[model samples]
Target: MTTPPHHPARRNLLRVAAAGAVSAAGLAAATPAWGRTTAAPASPPPGLSDPVQRGDLVVDVRDHGAVGDGVADDTAAIQAALDEGRGRTVYIPPGTYPVSTMLTVFGGTTVLATATTVIRRTDGPSIVGNGVLGDMTATGFDGESDIVIQGGVWDVNASNVALNGNGFSFSHGRNIRVYDVRVRDVQGWHAMELNAVETVRVVNCRFEGFSDPQGNRQYSEAVHMDYAGGPGHFTLFGAPDFYGCKDVEVSGCYAGPSADFPSYPRLVGSHGGPDGHQHTGLRVVSNYADQCTEWAVRLYDWLDGVVQGNQIVGGGGGIQIGPAGVQTGGNVVVSGNTLRGLAGVQEAAGRPPDAAICVGRLNNARTHRLTVADNVVEGVAMEGISVYRTDGCVVSGNVVEDCEGAGIRLHDAPRAVVTSNAVARTGGESIVVADASNAALVAQNRADDATAAGVRVTGTVAEVVVRGNVVRGDAAYGIAIGAGATGTWHTGNDLRGGYTTGPVDDQGSGSLTDPAGVA
Candidate 1:
């Protein structure tokens, strides 16, 4: 193996050429006509001794003796190109390059391939395709920088390879961008695991075909926004230290079934660190997720996050948010999304069932200032949008229809405002404020054709103001208050065509006001 000359910085060649264009104009203007008609052979073009010439800025994998014939190894040759092509672009042409071992990617390198390029994994043990080679110690975020793996189809070949590993696994990197890539058939582990990094973006990618090889860990994500929280949190083969991810964006991706296998169980989410050591500025937006065994998006513990504008279908559940800092669930926003056909297949033991969007892990009152607004939900197996154990939250401006349970329910949530929403054709109540949800304001909502009451204030609650709602169509009771409720005020509700039984069935003795004559 002959080494090239010790020259670098091919990335600066474009700016250097632009600068030289101005300099050449100035020089030609100053020098009076030393010009022959042939222009003196172009002055040999700059960087005469550089290892990477301008014409060879894109180093092809074939140049390093890689026969991408699908039968040859091509591992050593492609790896040779990668090791020497650091700070440059290694272009893999359209072919199937199978490897029996793992390939390592260095920092400041770009592994670019055509749309027809498929890097398939041969039979191997613990092989992660095109991952980092070194610097994976216990210290977090100390590994690499300026890495880009874009535009290829990375096939894990899960049926042949039983040892569980990811398609692309890297840790402790910053300024990483993975764009326009597709990963298929990852077994047991995630398709892409980016752990403990800062400032990353995964855009316009597709994750297809994931299954658990050992029949365990059936709920792995396609794109896991993980952190270095000790042994299993990272993809490296050892114990990593405690660090978290911050300023991450995973947008415009698709996570679902492949051509042959099922979709990844958890599409895109994070099972984050402890309460105090939390991640920040995470966004899972504008993606399509389906057929997940767990929640499509789970914000376990993060700060200042946004799960917005996603289209989810046929998942176990929709977006779920838990604690981030101390007891606080972080200042998060869940809005402008469409969720349908959720069943909550793998919900935790004491949690509610099949809510399209759930705001808490349980009846947790420490998550404050959360917002769930402007979403659309239909064909849900249970509740449409539910929150529990929160404080000062707002559930507003949503359209929920054809739910098996309540459209919107608040459990053990205090100081919540459920306003300007619409619920229709529910199997149970349209809206429910129960489980000691105190200081709630349920106003200006439109409920229609529920099997149970339009609005029900049950359990042990206090200071729940139900005002100015329009409950239309027929139900068991228009607004039924359970006997265990207290301080429930109802005023200015229009229940003209509602309630097959009666208009307002107020059984609680601690009630304050009633609907204005049910006319």
Candidate 2:
């Protein structure tokens, strides 16, 4: 919940919006009040045995007294069909069914339908959830497996209402697949709340429409990867479980606003992890996120994840990796993403300070062994790539331009290698090695038309080497070293183009420079 003071984030930020009010962070946007008070079953009911006694592989909802009309309440009929269709496919024909109650998903549940089969919910909890509460044991997550919920449009029509209702909430399961499902208009909550689950794949789904709840819910995610750490957390009410997500993949998905609703505040991330636990094997790739309030993808306290090939536009930030709510976890690779116009999204939400790609929370959180490479960040208001408090990071082969702040900045990060980057038209310095960033290397970079210097090293930093970099256009200087900065070496740099000030302003202590090639 902490960030660099320059990058104003969604911990406790209050900003205006183009659609509605921008709420605060940590909204606690769980499901309805009934989900909070209902005593969840410890296990599946005894009657939920193999329902194929009638010698059928599929159960149709129309045969179970479900009128396909939009006025009839099809809650009981759908539940009856699903209850009888365990270990089978429960099919619903093309129609609009008004569901007013929560539907339970069994272990072997496979609910299939066409794209026209819509389950429009009223003011209620999640439309579908597993009917099991957690026991907080070591073997709690080994409960359910082999479930599939696919090929339908679930509209959680939360317009003009002040309730917290999600689209689908799954918990304590394994090998779950939720693909080809379109969840629409999820007001005040996440489209899918995955709690303590493992091996979940959310593919080719369209999560449309996510607005704030009645209270503060600005940081609400569309697909929330949550921990089942009991109540007062991201779980759907009283689930006395304790496990994080493992092997989750959210790819080829669309996370933006619906035609009738506003965009969600966030998408595809986690925030409620507090113990020494770590979510591992998370892969977020090839998603198109347009015009969100805060960020498109954010992972906190995560270990071994890859966020690549995502196209993000118009959010407060882009992909951010850090250690929040826990200590010592972030070994992530963020690469090949395209982030553009983040300033437009952040200013529309009334806070425009975060970078296109951010690593580590602040100067205090320490992330280890990160790789940020080959990303294209453009038209952002703040820094292009901002890394703070990380150890042994590599920022290479990136293309950054048209940023209001530095193209690439490292703060309190040690042993970082920044190489082979291309930067142009930056308002601040093109590359900055400052704020106690020791033992770093900035080499073979191409910088052009920076309003500030080409390369700047400030604060109490030591052993920073800026070598073999090509500085072009009229910057303030080729290399500017501030006071109190010790042991900086700028060698083999080509500063052929002129600047406002002279090239290599050496004002630091124990700084060495190569002979200038041009004045």
Candidate 3:
């Protein structure tokens, strides 16, 4: 007999919540559905004990009729473990098990494959969580809490693979870990997709070879999060992809060569919405990126995150703070990173063209309280740090060199502070504040060997403080404050080595003089 249709309202409610579509009122309205539904049986199946302890049942995929050969299908041997009906660790010995289907596990379960245990798929997503329901069917398993997939290779050749999240109609799963694995050659979408998963840790893993067909031009990201495409409203989808997913850490991992689209290959990345609500609470530390067409790290709807000590080289942009049309605020600290070889459109042969970093505003929304400090940026095509339409952001203690454009460009910003930064050998202006206004501060920054002015301030900037900066060997003026600019204070700066002062037309009541100890 068919399983009675699980309560439609309740199922839809769960699906909506997982997808982050439910509103506050909708959530409250659906509460009764949850309360009224009879809970699933808590007891274990026959010959199974409650609170299924580890080491109780040991199943070897090889012994349980798995072929163990690199070319043989191992779906049956793998299913035997899941069918046993208890929490246990299924061990896969050192052999390549080729499978076309997705392998899923129940709650309180661990799938332990040795480093040499290779689960290769001729198709896509060798192992998956059966949380969401869709066509091109794969395995479905529940009990996500305390689930661990460690020490093996999950090769995905498919284009679209959806994992945990409310949008996938999953629930309350926590502490899922994927460690010490290699994921390669995903022919479809995101190699790894983490949806509303909490306390998830992915460490010591390698993700590579993301390729797509010509003209498809799809967006596949290596690791993506957020709630998208479910029955609920957008607000019900909850915080942005990484929001509310607390203490999520991605360390010691490598992601690169994100695929383009059309040939139906994987390797693209895109956010799910335009609502200014999602946020990312990510700690991307000690990771390495190279030759990724997209950004090395794309922070969408992010807030209060830390991106530090990461080595990012050769990409479209090393790190993109926020995409367009999102509200990103609160303590995004980027520090102690090394960025090099950011080639832009016109690079010499054999050199990639990209930017070191691009900090963009989301939908004209003001991003505030950003602290970018102590980073070394070298050989970038564009500005080392480019802030667009942001406020209350600070860039300090950074060393930028050999950039084709301005070392630091602040556009349409207010209440921004740039201090103690060393900008050198730039083909463009060393520091450019274009058309920015109101309470901006540029202090104690050094500009040397700039092809353009050391600092170029244009338009009407009110109450802008330019203090204690050193400008030397600039091709143009040491400080160029355009006509009609007003209310700028320039004090305690040392201008030397062929740098001359430009006309300072003070339109408003702002003083330009030296103050003691301004450095």
Candidate 4:
């Protein structure tokens, strides 16, 4: 499946087009395999009247001495039904089935449900799909393929302990697909837990109402994917610990904690990627995340991912890249998202006022070649978008407005581009490049009604270019090149009738060639 170097963009376009189809055929076709094959159901299974008879396999939980009454424990009968459903389709009729224990889906089986179907987790962990094969003596790599879990409403009654319960847990598998499922009231760690998996496609799912009964929101997550051992290792957990997964996609889903409670819901996160085995090739698109106390989307030590076309609201931060001692892998793209009102969301302990979109390093770790474009970040408490200690990044075509602090700030970022952005009514500087930033381009941006300077270059910056920008209604200097800054070039800006401290104040030894036209 190798295409030409010029063909990647075209291929991505086709894949995105194919991913939006509502049919299983379209999903199977659009999805690319990391290490295994995926064969979608060619046609919908026969009606839900009789036992599902596919070839020699037949599974009817009712025929296995099971009752779907909401009182009885049907775990043994349903487990027997699943055992009979190996290599076939296991069908559950539309009723309230009380499962007292975990039900495992063997390899090559499908669970299809009707509109009124419900699986209630009464005890033990919810559901486990073990895709690992063999003794697993080595460091990485395991088994199982083509495991599909789709179309059911799995519910846990907000039980308040983190023992082993997860709505669905799948690990050590390739080409695993979960489609059109809804999970609610999960009382454990996460709604869905995926670890050490490759080529996972979770589409059109709804996960809601994650809670901690002990009043500790730190452990609750909607979808957790971590605990990757080595490449292809078959590891699993109920909470996310992204260690070594690759080629993962979580698309077209609605995920949140409680709609009523202001709590910390780790919407999605990846923790430790050990031994330099970075979790890579992730795609998170077209999802809705709401009321998160932590970030709606976050990554640590991750590389080569795309977070696009999402509607994220009321989170600690809308999307957070590497933070504090985590060195991120390169070429991450964040675009086409609508993120609003993160400053008023519930904050976790030791967390500061959050940004709508941010890429930074708190310790010695660094981020490179990141792209933040075409996003709308408004009504935030701090900077709308901040790039700190990152190199070779691009901040373009974004609308950042009505923030309590600077609209866009670049600190210690070298060789970066900040272009074609709109910043308005910020409490601090609209755009700032400071702390030894060099060789940066600040071009074609517009700033208005800023409480501080429109564009401020300070802290010993060098070789910076400020060109073709428009600044109006700023409270302080329109373009301020502070003292001790050198090698600055200010040219062709439009700054008239708005600055209280006057325009184009050059305190440095750089050239300002457009004094009359700009100031």
List lDDT for all candidates, in order: 0.76, 0.77, 0.60, 0.70
Candidate 1 lDDT, 339-442, residue by residue in tens: 98877654566655757898775434267678999999999887889887888899999999999989999988888999999999998999999877887999
- Which lDDT tens digits does candidate 4 get at residues 1-519? 111122222233233334334344443454455412332222222443321222233244665656666777778888888888776556665566788666877667766655566888877665545432232432232445556666778876565334546788666666677777888777646778777678877788888776666665564567776755534322332222334677888888887765533433766766646546677798788888877766788776668989898888875667877733644566889999988887643345766665678777344577778999999988887778888878899999999999988899888889989999999999899899998679888999999999989999988788788988999994689998888678788888888846787997888885556545224
- Clashes per prediction? 2, 0, 40, 6
Report the lDDT tens digits of candidate 3 across residue range 1-519.
011123322233234225234443454455555332132222222442222112224444544667656777887687676545235566666667776555555565666666666776654333555232233221111225666666777666444433211111222255666667777666534556665555666677777766554423234456655443334311221222322334466777777653532211212222533454454566777777665655667666666677887787775557766644644555688888888886553224764343465666335665667888999999877767877767788889999999988898787778888999999999888887766646678889999988878877777666678888898893667877766466677877787658544423233444556565224
Please give the lDDT score at residue 427 for candidate 2.
Answer: 84
Per-prediction TM-score, please?
0.85, 0.85, 0.76, 0.82
lDDT of 2 by residue, 1-519 (tens): 011122111111112111112111111132234323122212212432221111144566766778767889998899899888777767676778888867877777777756777898875778887663232332346755667777789989887445778898877778787768999998777899988888888888899998665647777788898777765665454355667889888888888989887788777888646666678889888888888778788787788999999999886778877887457666789989999998633424554476789887533668899999999999988889989889999999999999998999999888999999999999899999988799899999999998899999988899788899999989989889989688788899999767988888988887777445223
Ten residues in sequence with the least summed lDDT for candidate 3 = 163-172
CA RMSD of each candidate after superposition: 8.0, 13.2, 12.8, 8.3
- In model 2, what are the clashing residue pairs, if there are any? none
Ranking by lDDT: 2, 1, 4, 3
